[model samples]
Target chain A: MEFIAGKYNYWIYVALMMIGFYAMIAKGNLIKKIIGMNVFQTAVFLFYISIAKVREGTAPILWDRTVLYDNPVPHVLILTAIVVSVSTTAVALALIILIYREFGTMEEDEILRIQKNGSAVPPGKPE
Target chain B: MIDFALLFFLVVCAVAAIQMRDLLSSIMLLGIYSFIMAVVWTRLNAVDVAFTEASVGAGITTILLIAALSRTRRMETKQCVPPANLLIYGTVILLTSAVLLYGTLDMPTYGDPGAPAHSHVAPRYLEKSYEEVGVPNVVTAVLASYRGYDTLGETTVIFGAGICVILLLRRKI
Candidate 1:
């Protein structure tokens, strides 16, 4: 019970991660896969933020001269990660649009079928 | 009380986003998931992280995804599920979870003051942030001053991504 009590947060995040992992691999639609990737990234952010928590600690502000502050490093690092995630999503969405324009579909299997059959809609040609 | 409720909400949103068939609904659920994660970060005293997550995760990401969805099909077409692929993914996920769980067993408790993470360079930043950078929010100070190069690189990467998107989607390409 003590083990469970102390580490439930990690366990929950891990489960959340698995959900995202399953979605990324098993989902048919490309957009759903992107959403899964976001969930996976968010789970990681939660894990890092959870690590930054301090017992009986306040937010990382220096208002009081003698107050315990949670670790600020993880918070700082996650900022960059969050920004990168947005950029990645933007790029991914743009690529998806291009894929749609070229193949007329976003379903993975359809895209593969079109590619395999090598129809007139050869991808990457400036349309 | 709020923690349990919020975590539960997060799980619901993540699962719903995964299982949702309509692309629009899935995108909305993911937005909600990001918003709830921001709230959870706040509850955990990571206000800055929460702020970033809210803006980037909940705000811009959802808009981008919606824009893409509008340009693409709304419903997923039928595709035959492959048991072999499922087995491969399942085996990989199970092995990863086991490894992660093993690593977690050695991690410091949720809020241990003496954890190595806290004892390392974190203390010096807390000790001298006001003097070195004179910023009230140590996170901002560290992010801007101590880690300025990383932030600059991050900005460059975002700028590059914007350029890539424009080149890929715009008529100019």
Candidate 2:
């Protein structure tokens, strides 16, 4: 009970991480993979932010000398990470745009099939 | 607790986002997930992180995804044939999660003031930030002033990504 009371946050984050992982590894669509990557990244940010919490702490703004403040390091770290996530998402979408133009399908298996059978082979699914 | 409820709702959104047939709706649901995740961040005393998550995750990501969807198919192919080796994949995911849970047993409890994360440099920043940096917002001070290199690195990465996008998307540059 004690462990459960104290560590529920970690357990919840682990579950979220697995959900993202499952989507990333199992989903076939290129965009689905990107969404999964987003989920996975946010789950990680939650883990970092959760640990930075202190029971009675206020937000990291130094409002008064008597008040406890949450750890700011993780907040700073996650801020950078969130921006990085956006830039990566943009770049990935650009790649997806090119992949669509070249192959005309976003399904992972279809892309692989095209790779194996060559572009001259009509796509397995009729357009 | 309210936290658990929010997290449970977040999980539902996550599942629904990935499970949707329309890629557009999936992206929208993901925006909701990030919004709620931002709320969770505020609850955890991370206002700055929550702010970024709200703007970048919910706001920017949704717009980018919709733009991407314009160039591609919105509806996922209807064939729901389960991936091969799904059982093996499930087992692997579960085992890894179990190991991570085990590892968490040694970690400090939620909101432990003495936790390693809250100790060390965090205390120094909290104590000295106002005096040394004159920035009441510790997160901003740490991000832009104290740990300037991380911000610089992030800026470089964004610049690189922008150049990569422009180069990749052009028909003939």
Candidate 3:
């Protein structure tokens, strides 16, 4: 049990990753897949934050006296990453909305059927 | 020991991602695989790389996959074919693994105090960073001052990617 406890954080990250991945792949709903993606990304963020930790270190600021400091490079890089992620998410969500408007349904199979039919019937109409 | 375990987990996630029947599940597994890869980068002491991987690999890439999947259909199990592309994929994997393993042989031993990376430039930065760059963090000095051009390029790449995505998704209006 000690061994398991020692590695508990790592294990949790892995489990969360798996659950997110499973949801993204197994679910037919598009929004559910985006949620899974968000979970997966958060797991990676957790991994980064865990590694940035230092034993008994303070912020990366200097004082009159020298003191141990946790590394701040990772934090800086992550800030940039967050901005990029938000931009990408905005674009992706916009595309998803467009797909819904065109197909009138988010189901992949149904959209493909309409595409294959070459506009014989407008979307969301009875056969 | 932990390193090996993490690597094993990464491999498992990658395999599961490739083998999954549903496209959505495969993309999700790919995100998990990316997260594990970020963990591996952190374990290797590349915290910056780990952060970028977490954000780009897990976050942005996953959203892109979800968007693509929403336009497509869930793949049917009966539509799956035998692994006829196995030989080509196996060869590519073998070549990549070989190249990476060979490159590792030339790398300095992990955490070697005498390595050039820790000796010449890094020590100078650590000792004189405050006086020279007026920054407490040597990494920031290196990134913002010494390698400013590279950082600018990276920012441009992000902007370009955003533009490409907009062009692909947006209508005439």
Candidate 4:
């Protein structure tokens, strides 16, 4: 009980990461995979932010000399990371659009079957 | 108490996002999940990060996904993977979770002020940011001046992604 209480935050984030990971690996739809990827990334961010928490501390802004503040490093790191995550998602969405244009579907199994059979979409051109 | 609620909602959202058959609703749950994440961040004193998560994670990501959804099939078309293959994937995921759970054993307890993360450069930044950078918000000071290069690199990456999106989606010759 003590162990669980001590690190419940980490444990929860770990579960979130696994949820995202399972979606990315086990799900068939391309959009589902992308959603899973975002969930996984956010879980990592949550873990880092959790590390920066101080029991009685305030936010990282300078309020008073005598006051404790949460660690500022992870917040800064995650700020940049959040932007990078969106960028990756944007690129991913773009790729998904092109994939749909070429293959006419976003289901992973369908795409793989098309690739293997080389029948649904022509080899060189989409026609 | 609130933290527990938010975490519970988070798990619920993730699971529901997985189980949802409609691609649109799944994306909406993803937004809800990101919003809950932002709340969790604020509770943890990551206001800047929370703002980013709300804007980027919930707002931009959902928009991009929905727009992409507009470009493709809306409903998920899933054919079951054979049970043997499903079992393999499940085993690997569970093993990874076990290893990560093992790792948490060594981590500092939640909100321990004396944790190693606080003993390093974080303390220095908190102590000297007002003197060195003339900024009250240490996160802003560190993001803009202390680690300006990384932010610049992040912007460059975003620019690259923008270019990539334009390249891939624009069909006109």
Candidate 5:
């Protein structure tokens, strides 16, 4: 019981990660894959924030008579990571739009089929 | 009990988001998921991270997804998923999870004061941040002062991503 109680957060996040992973590979739509990737990234953020929590701690701000503060390093690092996540999401959505414009379908299998049959217009040519 | 509830709902949202055939619904569910995750971070005393998650994950990310969905199909097709592909993906995920679980077993317990993460540079920052940076918020101080270059790089990456999106979607080239 103690072991379970102590590490349940990790277990839950791992389960969350597996769900995201399954969606990434099992889902057919390109947008669904990107959603899965976002879920996976946020799960990792949860794990890091979980690690930074200190028992009987408050936020990492200097305040009167506050001794215990949560670790600030992870918070700092995750800020950068969150920015990166947003940037990547933007770029990925742009790519998805381009893929749809070119192949006329967002389904990964269909896109592959289009490419395989050589139906897609070649690069740098008007469709 | 509240943590368990939050986590349970989080997993539910994750599953529902993935399983939803409507891409817009999935995107909304994902936004909700991010909001809940941000709340969890706030409960964990990671206020700064929670704020960022709420802004980026729930706010900006959802908007971008909706914008993208407007340009693409909303419903996923019912084509048969191949068993061979499932098997390969399942094996890879299981192996990776196993390795990660093994690694977690040796990690310090949650909130251990003596954990390597809390013991090292964190202590110095917590102890000296006010004196050195004169900032009440240690997170801001560390992000802006100690890791200024990293934050600058992240800002540049966001700028680059904006440029890429404009270049890709604004023209047919």
Candidate 6:
């Protein structure tokens, strides 16, 4: 339908966000959660870019003659955000690697168990 | 028309994000949500905000997530019992939504020429920004000059976050 097609971008955005959030909360894998977080952030980026568009606006750069300019402020802000995101990602990955080194398995429950017990225990141990 | 549909999609995305079980799929959905938000910003004529949302929200953030995923495990090890604090979470979500909806009720109608925003200092900036700051974009003028101090503070906060993340993740040398 024309109505559906006209607003397809928004629909896609929502679908992606839902998928990411669900993955972050539902999946037990820490790596998968990170992926979900990435997808979530990307959805926001798509939203911001879509807003910057103008039907007939020109680029922010000025010409000798008069011209209607598309907004450039969001572009500048997004650049900064990108840098920050990269730094954050680096840090998050480092922490994840450390977690893996500390625990033989990447499973959350196993890590929790190790944390609670302080040492590996036999499977049948009640305590 | 389109606006109502967009709002509906937003609500649907929020619910699905909360309800989905696969963390990977949820992350992808979050990206989709951000994209929709960008479209909303465009509809509202806030082009600058929309640009920032797209590049940062969709591109960099997604990459970061993938990188993080590579460093961690990919599967849930055990089944987790649902938390007992459901009532508290439900209450919090409800209160926040109510407050947000209430705030929206007092907002100016979309694209109203008589709105306070159009009559304020913004008009002056729109007229004189080129002569005053030599910038073609009024949004940049406002961000870099009118609210330069706030921008500076935001930059500082970002730097601090970077430092904190590094400190937390870096192995002691």
Q: lDDT by residue for model 5 over B1-173, one digit each (tens)?
A: 89889999999999999998889999999999999999999999999899999999999999999998887778877766788988898898898788878877887887777788988899888988899999999999999999999999999999999999989888673
lDDT minimum window of 10 residues, candidate 6 chain B: B104-113
Candidate 6 per-residue lDDT over residues A1-127, each given as its tens digit: 6544344445455555555555555555565556556555555555444434444554444443455444444544554554455455556666666677566555667778888989754333211
Correct interface contacts retained, every candidate: 0.84, 0.84, 0.06, 0.90, 0.85, 0.19
Model 4 per-residue lDDT tens digits across residues B80-172: 878998998899899999999999999988888999999978888999989999999999999998998989998998999999988877863
Q: Which candidate, 2 or 3, has the higher TM-score?
A: 2
lDDT agreement with native, every candidate:
0.88, 0.88, 0.57, 0.90, 0.88, 0.56
Off by over 4 Å in 2: A120-127, B79-84, B171-173
Weakest lDDT window of 10 consecutive positions for candidate 4 chain B: B164-173
The complex in candidate 1 yields a DockQ of 0.70
Per-residue CA lDDT of model 2 for B1-173, tens digit only, reads 89989999989998999899899999999999999999999898888889889998999999999999888888887555465668877888999899998899899988888888888888999999888899999999998899999999999988999899989988531
Clashing pairs in 1: none
TM-score of model 1 (CA atoms): 0.95
User: Alpha-carbon error at B59 in model 2, in Å?
Assistant: 0.6
Across A12-84, the per-residue lDDT of candidate 4 in tens digits comes to 9899999999998998888898999999999999999999999999999998999999999999999989999
Docking class of 1: medium
Root-mean-square deviation of every model? 2.4, 2.4, 8.3, 2.5, 2.6, 7.0
C-alpha lDDT (0 to 100) for residue B95 of candidate 2 = 96
Rounded to one decimal, what is candidate 1's iRMSD? 1.8
Mark the regions of model 3 whose C-alpha exceeds 4 Å error after superposition: A1-127, B43-48, B76-85, B171-173
What tier of docking accuracy does candidate 6 attain?
incorrect
- How does candidate 6 score on lDDT? 0.56
Residue-level lDDT tens digits of model 1 in B24-96: 8989999999999999999989999998899889999999998888777787766656999989989989998
